[model samples]
Target: MKLVKSLVAVAITVSMFSCGNQVKEVKTLNTEIDSVSYAIGLNMATQFKANLKEVNDDAFIQGYISGKDSTNLLVAQKDIQTIINTYLRKQQTAKMEEQRAKAAKEAEAKFGDNKKAGEDFLVENKTKEGVITTDSGLQYIILKEGTGDQPASPSTRVKVHYHGTNLEGEVFDSSVDRGTPAEFVLNEVIKGWTEGLQLMKEGAKYKFFIPQEMAYGAQQRGDKIKPFSTLVFEVELLEVLD
Candidate 1:
């Protein structure tokens, strides 16, 4: 009877120990599952916040809010804003480039017209003297007579004083402003000066009505002159040193 009682006590103790081990294992597994689920949930929330920030800061969204009703049409508003912003930027750039090209073309045209006009004036004026006539029906008078021999053909070095005006009697360039005589070579100057100086002897002065071609051509000498303008000048021959 004593041996049997001892064996029964040993069996009960082994069973209790086995049951406690099973309970501990189950608790550990449950804790691991709960931790994984929490991590997944946290990650999902973080991803959502990032997406929200991106959508809010996008330019398309801002544009939609400016023009459209966003309260009821969120998707449509966003789309419209994107399209409108893109279109406007492209249009603005294209228009600016077009304006630049147009300005360049106008400048070129003015220059060509002035050059042609000057050539025509030289052709019409047949007489060569201190005085000259322009095709534009303007006339120039000589003021002083030069004594030195004229320079070689196509040569440029010469010194003179000049006063310019328009047919309506508008004064333009005047050497008297700087209180000094203007100097330039014939070849280096406008067509009008080149042709006109050839006719002058040393100590001779001539007045000229220079068309745009003979003056600055298409370019304006200053604010007072315009493109394709006509000019008048009283030139006094001081020296022909070339």
Candidate 2:
């Protein structure tokens, strides 16, 4: 009965496609495809367009058209290759650094209040009941106790649920939000997790306060996380996978 309903559903879907929008483009590629290529291409064009002016767009599109038509003779092939191999990397790097500086300046303007909040939070948090601070500056409070065997080494793989945030309590990442458990080698994570998990057993839950050095340090991860950012995590060890 389920199979029949599924077949009917498929038929209805097919009929909807057949009766509604008929794409006039020829299927020269044989395998099923859609306007995704055009959509993606248009999206990319808009993104680039946002960073450029009409004159720049005209120049780029005309140059591309020229390339497609094999009409280029103005610039030497070697010069074009040199532009790509030599100057492009430097230009891209400069642009990225400029963007990073801009982001840092903006972060100072936005979450500056919480910039020192983590340090203060940790200072008081460490004094709380059952809160243990390791010599290396990792602080954790046991949320749930486990009777299962504790991981013997950093090489052990474990499954866990975690929610990570910066000093300002802005969430950086969360397996809980994704509604999925994370499985990873114990040592493969940040130093804080590597050391903190060693004190845990299967079915154990702990809230960890990881200092900036133990986390991403002075380096940035993507855009949201900034340099020298302290992190807080609520980690639950679900299983010792290996």
- Considering every candidate listed, which one attains the maximal lDDT? 2
Q: Which candidate achieves the best TM-score against the true structure?
A: 2
Q: Assess candidate 1 and give its TM-score to the true structure.
A: 0.45
Q: Supply the global lDDT for candidate 2.
A: 0.70
What TM-score, to 2 decimals, does candidate 2 have? 0.51
lDDT of each: 0.59, 0.70
Question: lDDT at 236 for candidate 1?
Answer: 80
Encode model 2's per-residue lDDT on 1-242: one tens digit a residue: 22222222332222112322343344443333334444443455564444333335445444444444458655554565554345445656777899878877776676565456656777888999999999998999899988787888999999899999876678889999999999999889999999999999988999999876688755677666776677889999888888
Please give the RMSD of candidate 1 to the true structure.
27.5
What's the true lDDT of residue 154 in model 2?
94
215 in model 2: Cα distance from truth in Å? 0.7
